[model samples]
Target: MSTPTLLTGRDPRSESALLLLSAASGAADAFVFICVGQVFAGVMTGNLVLLGASAAGVGEHGVALRVINALVSYSFGVMCCAWMSERLRWPLPVMLLIEVALLATGAVLWALDLITSDGDRLGLLVLIAVAMGIQGRIRATPTNYFTGTLTSLVSRVTLRSRDQGDSWVAGRLIAVVAGAAVTALSVRFWPGAAAMAAVVPAAGALLVESVPRRTSRG
Candidate 1:
């Protein structure tokens, strides 16, 4: 399908799907920081800085190791998404389905009390980081408005809104915060399902992406 230009029309379906994915990142990052460790699953800058802090000898006991692991694992996910999506030529939803599956597995592990030790923590971090990495790349690598740099995205949003009168860009930042808040509540009130539940938005995104696009009549 051609890219929907919001100057004259909009693709709420596609935008909504992307928004849900944004919320998933928020939820996943919050879950990792609060439950698993101090490192962020989606935000690489945080982990990188934390790693630097560790190098300066001013961080948690295992901070260096964990952040490095998360960084490497997250990259692996990004690589896999880029490679497989090209080789397999599957729909975007199918690729995100893989991410959701990985997220669900972590949820299951946590809910079942399977992640109870250092080794388990390592595994959980890897799982979530990989999933987040895929989330980070899926949009950037596609023919979409999503970009790696926030400055670029904001610039594009401003330029389009002014010239083309395109709809404002997705409220991805808000979605992330909302997801984090919900995940925090889930972790506090419903520990068993917290991990699994945190992934609801991602699953929702997958469903949204699976829907057939609407066609306009002449």
Candidate 2:
């Protein structure tokens, strides 16, 4: 059997899937930052900066712990997903289901107001970080983080005036911004609802994957 091309596919469905994943990333980030303190769920680079600031005595109290927990959890998630992908044939769907389970758990915890203590909050953070880490690995296009996407977008746009790269990057950025805005607003008014809302896009991506593609007859 040949190796699967999970990422690096350029089909329309893949593009749509990437957009949904990007939106999911945005919502997850906003939800965690707002409810679980100022820690990012998906953007590890920002977490690293926060870690650095804390080390230099410039960050808020407990920020270092949050950053550390997120980093460790995300690393664990990535390692686990990588191993699973290597061993499992249906790695993409399996990873997506795992992410859904994690997010659903977080949503339940948030809804029950169980994330009152540092430990409780850390648990929530771990779930979100793990889900996002798996997402970062699964998507063919960049989804969970924007820095790399933005850099690549700039390079592509600079080299070519009108191209697929421009459209793809622009669409993804828009999706991320839109998702963050919607979820942030929801979180501001209804925290529990926002937690649940983060799961929708991931679910949508799964639905997209479930649809069978039509093949041409010779």
Candidate 3:
């Protein structure tokens, strides 16, 4: 067995934030896939395949453009957040607040019924994609940014402050599924709240990260 990191160094708040973040990712992807467009917001691999199919004229070209819009906006968000966080010294809470703003914008648009037209679809796609990209860029140990994709998550389960365990991985999967499930139900029954699925969880993550951890002397 690998040497365990000090358990005292762990903060349950951080783990809760991670689970909420994972749920946010899952909810965002699900809403974008269903409501915004048929393409994924964060799952770039799936979008790439859809893009190729569009180029081959397998489906409507408009779908291709939507995929491209998501890809571009997602990249832009990743680059900007990376620069500000790594180079500009922006804090994690501030970074998460930015993401929350983006998610909130998307949710408001949906709740306001502003995304009905064909042109509005692209904008919605960009908003969700950018938010997802920013969520992916958050800097925190044990947060598992890799939760964006389950396929690769199982292969790499290293935690910076805790020993690897089944609960570690299972918790993330369940969080993701729970997020997706909530979004799916909302989209099915309460379509107006489709994008709100991610917004609330994202806000929760931001709040969790914003709080100062309590200290105790050993």
Best by TM-score: 2
Residue 117 error, candidate 2, Å: 1.1
TM-score, prediction 1: 0.83
> 61, model 1: CA deviation in Å?
1.2
TM-scores for all candidates: the values are 0.83, 0.93, 0.83
Number of clashing residue pairs, candidate 2: 0
| Top lDDT prediction, candidate number | 2
Candidate lDDT (C-alpha), each = 0.75, 0.83, 0.76
State the lDDT of candidate 2 residue by residue for 64-180, as single tens digits: 999999999888888878777766655577778898889988988888887889888888999999998888777667788888878877877788755755686788899898888
Please write out the lDDT profile of model 3 over residues 1-218, one tens digit for every residue: 33212112145676677778878888988888888778888777778999999988887648888888988988888898888776777777887888889889989998999888878988888888887777666634333234343444545554333344445556767877788899999988999998898989889988977877687899
Model 3 residue 20 lDDT score? 85
* Residue-by-residue lDDT tens digits, candidate 1, 49-68: 99999998997789898899
What residue runs in model 3 are displaced by over 4 Å at the alpha carbon?
1-11, 139-165, 216-218
- lDDT for 28 in candidate 3 is 88
lDDT, residue 86, model 1:
66
Name the weakest run of 10 consecutive residues (lDDT summed) in model 2.
Answer: 1-10
RMSD of each: 4.5, 1.6, 5.8
10 residues in a row with least lDDT, candidate 3: 1-10
Native-vs-model 3 lDDT?
Answer: 0.76
